[model samples]
Target: MSDQLLQLLFTGLTLGSIYSLIALALVTTFKVTGILNLAQGEFVAIGALLAISLYATGIPMFAAFILAIILVAIMGGCLERAAIHPARRASGLTLIIITLGLSISLRGLALLIWGTDTYSLPAFSQGGPLIIGGAVLNPQSFWILGLAVITLSVLYAFLGLTYAGKAVKAAVINRTAARLVGINPNTISFWAFVGSGALGAAAGIFIAPVTMSTYDMGFMLAIKGFVAAVIGGLNNIGGAVLGGLLLGVLESYSAGLISSGLKDGLAIIILLVVLMVKPHGILGLLGERKI
Candidate 1:
């Protein structure tokens, strides 16, 4: 019984890390651009699929991963310049709707390119599961967790210790003031999408070994990530990561102890409860400053 619980915990953390990455990507974009990107998940699918294709061409694993992530980031910037930039004067609601449309279009493009097939990436390390007190842990799980930690750490440092990062925060906090201070809102917005795209793609590459990659997988992932973001407080970045891990653990326990069939529904239930109890999220308090 103890082993079973431990096993569930391990699984939950692994999956949660992926959710954290996705949620972090979403929240970061929203913070910098004030635009919630519903199409973020498509970057994940495209990254994994593109990585697979590149790796198949005999490129080394590291090179393939870099190439795919960079390509997606570039595409994100291009989309922002071509589609989103022109709509700069549109209302907030209109911008969100445009993102929704972008999501649909990306998914359709993915389907056309990858078809209905599913693909997988090789685990970062080849090894059998490790047994800890009779509970088994997969090697890929560590890679996922490590990736989450590294990504979070790097992002935190960049946002906290750099001039560009401060400029971004300033732009989001007050566009008029930021502009007066010589910052460019459009450039900030463009970079936000690019960073968001890179984060999404990196998540897909790491999780592909376990979840498998499919053309239609991004939409559901985006939904889950959004739920995580809301649970953590849309305005709080750290809250998003904690929220993803918390949600993942709860989902794991529900599946293991109650019924696997109820797993997907569990997220929505938690989201509702969170919204009702503390709408600002676990870390976000009323009148509190955002990070």
Candidate 2:
């Protein structure tokens, strides 16, 4: 491939990794709780801001990143318990509205804490771009890609191999049955929120170097990630990954060959088209599915 094409492809993959992580967070939470979390993006913003703050306070960057993830994960669990658990028996629409409110509140809180200023994080590695196969790749791109792979792999193992993971899956598939089988859906939902928060935080920290961090960035990322999740089939983890990568590539190509302004618009168009033609998503199953 030509250098320009290669560059676009690499950049697209890197961008896709971020989207995939966000989509994964959404899907995981939805699977367990049956509610789409509007505040998921705020978790990402919190992660980035907290990591920067901690790092600036004389903590090592890696330690700061880890601490931010843990803090965000705890916050997610607390939010679930304090705000969502009370309304767990409410209608799905009601729950969604609550999450939207939570999103707005979180944004305002972030603004109060960090103001409107945008901040940048230094890349995990300090270096220039690496040229391979005629493509100039950012050093941080590898970190993003590697972390994405590792995150997905760990998730797969958790869902496919562990007992707790199986219980969570069972709860998603049939809550009543899972309850009869001695699994507490509430516990599963709490853990799902924690896991999603951790994923969102990690994605934010990793992408901060490329995208920068700001209080308002969460909503955009959430929208894009939601598009990816819908395209891939919200209940299917693998589908979320595929959708994110596809969306990323589409956006990257549009920005490179067409116009940067059109990239987001194009993604929304694709999302609309997908919903019209294949409402269940690319990998979503036919017929009624629980998750």
Which consecutive 10 residues in model 2 have the weakest lDDT in total?
282-291
Poorest lDDT segment (10 consecutive residues) of candidate 1: 282-291
Q: Record all residue pairs in model 1 with backbone atoms less than 3 Å apart, i.e. clashing.
A: none
Q: Compose the digit string of candidate 1's lDDT tens values, residues 1-291.
A: 999999999899888888888898888788767789999999988988999999989999989999999999998999899878999889889999999999999999999999999898888888888999999899998888998898888887877789988887776566688889899889998988888889999988988889879998887778778888988887777778877888888889999999999988888888888889988887766455566
- Tens-place lDDT digits, model 2, residues 186-283: 89989988988899999899999888899988888888899999988787777788889989988998899889999878878988988998878977
lDDT of 1: 0.87
Runs with alpha carbons beyond 4 Å of true place in candidate 2: 284-291
> Model 2 residue 46 lDDT?
94
Best by TM-score: 2
**Which sections of candidate 1 miss by over 4 Å?**
172-177, 285-289
Clashing residue pair totals per candidate (backbone < 3 A): 0, 0
- Total backbone collisions, model 2: 0
